[model samples]
Target: MMDILIHWIREVDTDIRLGRPPLAGEARSESLAVPMMLQCVTHELLTLDPSLGARYRDIQEWSVQKALSHVQVRRMH
Candidate 1:
């Protein structure tokens, strides 16, 4: 599952780099993958130490926000 997530992430990143919006199917998959990825990360962090979950969730949230901002900036150009 991690491998598949990574592959999708990379595919999306590549499309962004090339200044192309993802195809409809890819965009749908990405919408699904992001939340699933966050859940997986949260679960793993909880397994390691329950106290880490909130902090890690915040970090993931920030990371996603930053990525979106970057994409928006790219689109402006």
Candidate 2:
């Protein structure tokens, strides 16, 4: 579990590094819309049962996509 979490953290850090840094005027408190789900998955796997963690990953993806679409719809209005 620790190994996987470490790997995820590395991937997230790499994503941030490869992506553009935020604009100077932008807020840092608000997270990037896309990777927020990754963060959620990280949190869940950290706390949830190790045996069920893989299933949690599947659930996390579905939940994040649903939430993201809802947010997108609101933004489009």
Candidate 3:
């Protein structure tokens, strides 16, 4: 759930960045991975249909506490 939520966040951010108006092919091409990864995770997680709600619930909790995770990640890496 943590991983998928992180990827979901990346996809949203990437889409906002890459989906800007009037961009050229090269620029749009550079940031393709995030959305693509989002697709993959969406497929993977949704495959477990019934359990996804619980997983997503946890992700929501994590999102609400993201500042703590960001600090931890920055400190570690």
What TM-score does each of the candidates earn? 0.33, 0.31, 0.31
Model 1 lDDT, residue 21, Cα? 63
Please give the ranking of all candidate structures by TM-score, highest first, separated by commas: 1, 2, 3
RMSD, model 2, all Cα superposed?
Answer: 8.4
How do the residues 1-77 of candidate 1 rate in per-residue lDDT, one tens digit apiece?
Answer: 64454445545464323335665666422243454455567577679898876556654674476446435343554
> How badly does each model clash, as a count of residue pairs?
0, 0, 0
lDDT of each: 0.53, 0.53, 0.50
Candidate 2 collision pairs: none
- Candidate 3: C-alpha lDDT: 0.50
What is the C-alpha local distance difference test score of candidate 1? 0.53
Q: Write the per-residue lDDT of candidate 2 for residues 34-56, one digit (tens) a residue.
A: 35655576566758667766755
Q: RMSD per prediction, one decimal?
A: 8.7, 8.4, 10.5
Error of 1 at 76 (Å): 44
